[model samples]
Target: MKPLNIFYAEPDADRWFKYDRYPRRLIRRIFRGPQRPGGVMMVAINLMKGLDRLNIPYRFNDYRYINKHPEELACIIGKPQVLFNREWKNPVLFGAGVFSHPIDHAKLFEQYPNLVKILVAGEWMRDMFEPYYGDKVQAWPVGIDTLHWAPQAIEKTHDFLIYDKTRWINEGLPQPFIEPLLQTLNKRGLSYRIIRYGSYNSDELKQKLHTSKAAIFLCEHETQGLAYQQMLATNTPVLAWDKGGYWLDPEYYPHRVQYSPVSSTSYWDARCGLKFSGHDDFEATLDTFMQNLHNYTPRDFILDDLTLEKCALKYVDIVKSISE
Candidate 1:
């Protein structure tokens, strides 16, 4: 098996605080432990873990080694500036938030002619990028760590765990979406808990999932929603807000670009749970979801396609395709 060269230069060394001197750095390490990884950093982290579990040979962020062996396939997973002053002589798989969009870095292709492939998290993202980059764009999602996110033996306490991650402020306030759901839960006399995105950590979420019978995922759309998938891995079904329409990202919607048929959960099926477009349909859908909760086998879906080893093997295949 050929060794892969992977590079990720994000969540920079000075992300938490400036450790200009040894004393400050020591204090930070002693007090704060380590800074928690953000979304992009987690993608790189999980991919490496998957590779490790598969026992696949790979070099991580070894520029000097890569320079010596220029013939090997190199993957730049994030942060475009990693290639600014460096000269990589091999074909590269570039994306996972390398840029906000292809148009943002219009000259990148000309600058780095060796970037043979563009990586996006899902088919919808690939669709958005396909026009600009053609067949070079590929969809690949990082696998969830199912072992750590498995169902716990604890008793389920709450009927619902509302996950709030809605990001479009101009479309209107979150109250329009959330208030109705809360009312429904209240009227039914169901116990529930609300967890806003970015306000909680993984350990906190895992505990909540263990105690909750189901989840109400409130998100505009997802490239690949790892949190909801984590919920699925725990056998906690989700009632997702999948208001399918034009890609309404304020940065690139209506004015700059227009795309359609986006999703909240990119890799989902009927077995996962239910979906509601908005307030009009949410009530009906929620009732149906509650009635059919016992029929959902979400964990089986995760085990089938999104396991660490399975996704690692898929990644290996992508690397091999580009190399050949």
Candidate 2:
């Protein structure tokens, strides 16, 4: 049988850029999709390459054509705030995180019973969606292109690279946690640089990761922690927070948003890196991290779990299972 036509949704144009000159830019025009300053765009681009490698025919954000033809597959690749219609017969939500409220997701699923599958980023998400969507939800984290993201033979530039995003403060993590952590690091006379969200583009970010010895990631929450994984892909050990935040009100900005004890969605480990619970835990772990940074072989963990080929093969299997 001929492969199904996969209509992949494109990332928001304004939120992303075209960095084709970068060596890491995967398959030309097709795989070279828009790039957000962060990891989301890279995830979309990698998935595009995976689709190409598997010979799955695809189009980006052109819903009119896919909508007109009911037989093709519609793949939503990011947070679906708008521009989605329940028109396609084989609709699959791939790598979607917590964009809508739980109640909203339930309504969408009920409205579109033809929705074949909802592939999310981690087991935590799978658990979140399973109760409402039943067996349709599955875990499918974004894969890494290890070829471009792997550890290099270059010299390490910084002792500790602080990967903190301002969004974390708004979304979940408060200043109490972040400010004190930074103060503690400064007091220890640690050499570090803080790279905020919009400070670097895709190529520059990759280059920065390659040069860094270690990182401290302070993000609110992630379905898969793509940036954290990217840091690990560079063999750069990371210390991340294990907790996350959620929306209780689901009505407004930071809508009833507050920190909650939640399961991590990444393949984090001592071998790759560490996760701290609070200020005390982080402070306690700092000494161990500095002393044995070399012992943490994060690149290997990423290679084993988050590689392009591995993700593509899994995607193909999922598609086949649904199509057949």
Candidate 3:
């Protein structure tokens, strides 16, 4: 049998998934009919690339939410043999299923319960959901676009920039640590300029990641660290927190990527790139970050790790194993 046509929907306007490019490439192969939104990135990105690789045809039903037109979305989903979600009309196609960070699982599950095949980012998360949705969990970490992620050597450039839009403060992340991080920058005196944004637009955020030095992600309630991969694609490092491990890639380190342990939440391990739990310790972390900044190159991140072909293979597995 041929592939299935999928209609992927990412209506999270509040926080765009920033996955436009991915869907475009994936809608090409193994598609016989319409496809619906699967879980988060692992499923979404993989399926998107699978279709794209096989040159399978598909649809992008983004209008479902952006335009508030479920009727239009229904039409786009078209008729299929098996729908990905029960809520999805037939001949419906389901990719992996829905996935969210630790904090948002309950709410997300409530909203998209039909979302089957839950995909997780880290190992622990797979365990976390084993009780609630046992045997359905799959570790689908983020992938990087070597071509798009590569620093154009000219796309954009900045020295040691930390950009985050999350209201970590309002979320009780504390400001004591932040002060130290800033102070470390001040003491380093490298003129490290920090960039930040208020709105949560994917395009705007991607632009920031593509052009900045590194991402300062302090979210204590995140699902996956797809954003970190996006930043790595731009040759940027990441200074992330442990509260978000379920979402962040475990490969993250203190050089190309540094993270905090939940226990060490009060403090960050200062390393090649440096990780600090509190901004108050920023002075110390920033001091190390500056001292070793030049040595911590982008190559350390391995931006080319996830290739389209490999991702396509994973998709083939899902499509082949579907409950035909």
Candidate 4:
């Protein structure tokens, strides 16, 4: 019997440490990690996602340094195989861990006879990849690093805790949410601090979230919302727009994650999350959220299964299927 092999072909990137919590023991091969962030996929953050539970004991092989040719990428294989994306070819059996680009999996199979399948993150992303790979692409949201984002025992306040990007004010909605939210909050004579972790320390972000009453994220669109999940884990009430914005923020469609109605006033319960459409009607939604903020003690949830650890296991299973 022979041990199964898998390659962990990390890019030449930096901040790989940010994902240090992600398990790196599942591979039998490696190409050294990258030297900087945003290497391949607009930032290819995926390189280090779900690092919290990375512990599958396996051998790790070294990279074959070539003069200048691009690093040879070995996909979803357990055996040590070497080939260029152009020369050595095999039908792509599946795109289990593949992200969506402007291409489809079938065409991917056609263009590169070696590509047989592709599993994307979600329906939105699938649309991007389906055109290039065809029926080969599917959506399967990846997991996050939970251990670093779990709940803790801490004292909290009963006030409005709005968690958002710093741009909320400088980049307030030209004529909508932001501008109105500012006016709305001011009129009520309420004082709340907006926490933006653009480049802040993790400890600091955690501290603010714990003390605050709720976490609010109102953005355009998101594919997968990592921060939202973390807030949920902490039991902090969440407020955001519907349909999620930009993949950079983990998006939750169909109300999977909780987001307070950006236009509601009944925000006292911090159960799952509240949500509102980013539509013109967001004003009312914001009003509702503001009202809810007036009289609510944030509550937490028992999100044990949704942890990043569990998410990683599911991803590993997809990888294993592709390998098999």
Candidate 5:
């Protein structure tokens, strides 16, 4: 069989437009071996690793060069805009969705059937898009690169950690979500640091997390929430919101509630971390998380459930199904 052709959009200046579906450049980490920092890049790298293990012949290229070559069976990651209003032999959209702004699917899909098959990182995403796209959407979790994110024999340096995006302060989570958590941490007299998503590269972040006891995650919404999984991969437990604000009523707490493509909860398993609705029971939740932190084996959970090899096999299966 011929190899699967994979195309990813090149990171460029113009790709950062208001509602473009291109990948954003996160922190660049100087790490040796099979792991890099960015979530999207890591997904690509792990997929490549899976293909290599299976001896599958494949080519990786920038989406810009896709039209320059002859048409054939191929898989596209990143932006699907390039494939729109055009024709191709067979195209697969892996981990594709709108990240920033709303999409007019009625107009876009009506214009061109660019996406033939689609794979998402979570079941919730599939549920949200399936009604509009029909039987084309499938749930395929992008598992973690365990080798790069596994736990180590390191001493704990801080009592707690706050893992979040830098944009949360400005755009995502406002004072309603932030102030209560900060007050709780301060009241407990815990030594903590807020590590923004883009602030540190993989190696740097790994080092910080290795020396931390626990983490609290704040984000707008998550399809897969790779960063939270990465923290879990390091055996550091997390406390995160259980529900997406999009489904919640706007009247009760309108400050941080925002729209999202899909509703997903990533860091609220009993074996990994804790969950909270709002400031109502946050203190109690924190108390429980702190009390049960030592018993949680989050790294083991990732190893068993979300390994890259497992995810790759699923990807291969989907490709085979679609190809056949």
Candidate 6:
């Protein structure tokens, strides 16, 4: 039972303002509740939970322990700033949402050229980074907690749960894709519930999934769509907007970088459900998807590839692979 060194930090405390400090922060927490953690934070949280399930020994954010054992592998799952200030002696397994793009952090990559592995969520993301980082880049998605996301014994009150995470802003305009979809759903006399990405919490979404027959995921792309995966883990089929083409991040698209064949659902299979490109194909796809909805066994896919213990073991293997 060897121990593993893991480091993670986000919403870095040093960057907190006066209002975000001590008494004020405490008051805010009391009145407003603690702020919900974003995707990157969840990645670290889920990994630790997975490790715990396997009874794996691991030290979290224990920098002193890391300093003492420089020859050990240090898995840094987090904000790049944690690694920026100092040169690490340990072989590192850097995972999860560390960098948005390689162009933005060329110097960071250069500084830590010996990083055992630079992990992204999917193969498409790996392709985007491979040109710059070469063989050092690998795709490694975190596991989902199947027990938490399991199907509930509830009556399905709605036909679809519309999960809108379309991030591209149209400059003071409503989302282009959603309105039309809503209209079509109305015309078809379908019962559905709409939940915007940042507006709703996980519990609310979980309830919606339990009540809905299926989910409609409207996102441009996902490095690894945790929410959508959760929906699948709950045995809910998804009608995803998988407009596969060049990466469309405004920061690095046509002019800067043109990585192709990007997907809205990074980890998907036939068992998960259907995919439609946009308004054009959506109606037809929806009809077909609904017609064959009963056949989908999305939870099976999760059990096979992404159970908590399974992914934790994979992470252990990844860490062990790093050279001392």
Q: Taking the candidates one at a time, how many backbone clashes does each contain?
A: 0, 0, 50, 62, 0, 0
Off by over 4 Å in 3: 10-50, 53-116, 155-157, 168-177, 197-215, 243-274, 279-283, 297-304, 322-324
List model 1 lDDT by residue over 187-224, tens digit each: 98989999999888889999999999999999988898
Q: Any runs in candidate 6 off by more than 4 Å, and if so which?
A: 13-28, 107-109, 169-175
Per residue, candidate 3 scores C-alpha lDDT tens digits across 218-299 of 5453434444545555656556544334223333332333333222122112321445555455456655655565565543
**The candidate that achieves the highest TM-score relative to the unseen native structure:** 6
Q: What's the ranking of the predictions by TM-score, best on top? A: 6, 1, 2, 5, 4, 3
Worst 10 residues of 4 by lDDT: 260-269
228-270 in candidate 4: lDDT tens per residue?
5556666666766553333332333223333322222111234
Point out where model 2 deviates above 4 Å: 10-40, 53-69, 79-83, 89-98, 166-176, 244-260, 263-265
- lDDT score, candidate 6: 0.86
> Cα deviation of 203 in candidate 1 (Å)?
0.6
Q: Against the hidden true structure, what lDDT does model 1 obtain?
A: 0.85
Ranking the candidates on lDDT from highest down gives 6, 1, 5, 2, 4, 3
Estimate, for each residue in 199-219, the C-alpha lDDT of model 6 and write its tens digit: 988899999999999999999
Candidate 2, 94: how far from true, in Å? 5.3
Candidate 2 lDDT over 204-302, as tens digits, reads 777777777888887656667777788888888887766555523336335533324344435676678777766778887887788887899988888
User: Least accurate stretch of 10 residues (summed lDDT) in model 1?
Assistant: 11-20
Report the number of backbone clashes for model 2: 0
Error of 4 at 264 (Å): 18
Candidate 6 lDDT at 189 equals 96
Against the hidden reference, what TM-scores do the models get? 0.92, 0.79, 0.57, 0.59, 0.78, 0.93
Cα deviation in Å at residue 290, candidate 6?
A: 1.1
Predicted structure 6, TM vs. truth: 0.93
Candidate 4 lDDT at 16 equals 61
The clash number for model 1 is 0
